[model samples]
Target chain A: GIQVEQSPPDLILQEGANSTLRCNFSDSVNNLQWFHQNPWGQLINLFYIPSGTKQNGRLSATTVATERYSLLYISSSQTTDSGVYFCAVPKDGGSQGNLIFGKGTKLSVKP
Target chain B: SQTIHQWPATLVQPVGSPLSLECTVEGTSNPNLYWYRQAAGRGLQLLFYSVGIGQISSEVPQNLSASRPQDRQFILSSKKLLLSDSGFYLCAWRTGTITNYGYTFGSGTRLTVV
Candidate 1:
């Protein structure tokens, strides 16, 4: 079983501020993903980066598979971004396997 | 485009009541389905996953069970609920062979056992 730890368990930022969340995993992984769980409890897909770097609008994710960690960057945040961000990776070596999730980073963006 | 639908956005049940939560996927066939439970402000816990109809794998030992009667349908059931079962349950789906895309999650169901 792989263990995942997310840093800065809780965070609060003024609107328009930037922030970074980190996820560290205990084992090698072939599938890694970032998700945003909104206030209503819907897990929204943010990024699927098993390795390398990817950006989507104000959000970007970088995964250093060799180092066994990943980073998520939120640029110019907004109130709507107030929620829990989770990092998940497959327990096995491939995407077809089930995921082991980290507790997550709870973020609050204030206006 | 694929989508997942989960019913009964919220539920309140007695400790001994039976429970059933249904999830159905559309626009995709032979997709992988999963059930996850999350406690308040916590990460998700994988309960069950199905690769196809009638094939289910349980990740954790619990009173809850899952069934897939159709290619795109998944059901989570419990004979008698427990107070510990109170949490947010989510249904999600992803392409079995298309590994590049991340999973798509349903809106989720909030279950509270009194």
Candidate 2:
């Protein structure tokens, strides 16, 4: 089993501040994804960056697959972006998309 | 475009009560379905998944069981709920492919057992 660990189990920031979250995997992975679980318990897809860099609005992510690490950057965060950010890794055995999730980084952006 | 639907938004049940959560996917057939549980602010835990009708693989051994009666429908049921069974239940589906099948999660059901 692959263990995924996330940094800063809890976080609090001002509305205009920027922050970066990290995810580290214990083993090789075929895919890496980021998700945001809102206060209402809905899981929203953020990014699916197995490698390279991708940006969506004020949020961006970069995965260095060779180093088995991924970084998510939230720039000028907003109150609506406050949630539990999780990183999931897909096993490399075959085509099973079952994800091994990290405990997540709980972010709170105060307005 | 694929969409997943989960119902009841919220539920409260006695410790011994039976429970059933339904999830359905539209615009796709033979998709892979999964059930996950989140305890408070904890991470999502994989409970079960199905590749097709009547095919289920349990990721955790618990009082929970899942069934797929149709290609687009997946159900999670419990014979008797436990206080520990109280959590956020999420239903997700993705296309079964080697390339990539990004999962689309439902709004989730909040269950409380007392």
Q: Give Cα-based local distance difference scores for all models.
A: 0.92, 0.90
Q: lDDT by residue for model 2 over A30-96, one digit each (tens)?
A: 7888999888788888888889999999999999999999999999999999989999987555365
For candidate 2, give the lDDT. 0.90
For TM-score, the strongest prediction is: 1
Q: How do the residues B1-114 of candidate 1 rate in per-residue lDDT, one tens digit apiece?
A: 677899889999999999999999999988889999998769799999998899999989999999999999999999999999999999999753556867889999999999
Highest-scoring model, DockQ: 1
Candidate 1, position A42, lDDT: 82
TM-score of chain A of 2: 0.96
Q: What is the TM-score of chain B in candidate 1?
A: 0.95
Candidate 1 CAPRI category = high
- Across A1-111, the per-residue lDDT of candidate 1 in tens digits comes to 789999999999999999999999999988788999988788898988989999999999999999999999999999999999999998776445578889999999999
Error of 1 at B92 (Å): 0.5
Clashing pairs in 1: none
Superposition error at A70 for model 1 (Å): 0.5
TM-score of each candidate structure, all chains considered together: 0.97, 0.96
lDDT of 2 by residue, B2-112 (tens): 789999899999999999999999998888889999997688899998888999999899999999999999999999999999999999886535675477899999999
The candidates' DockQ values read 0.82, 0.72
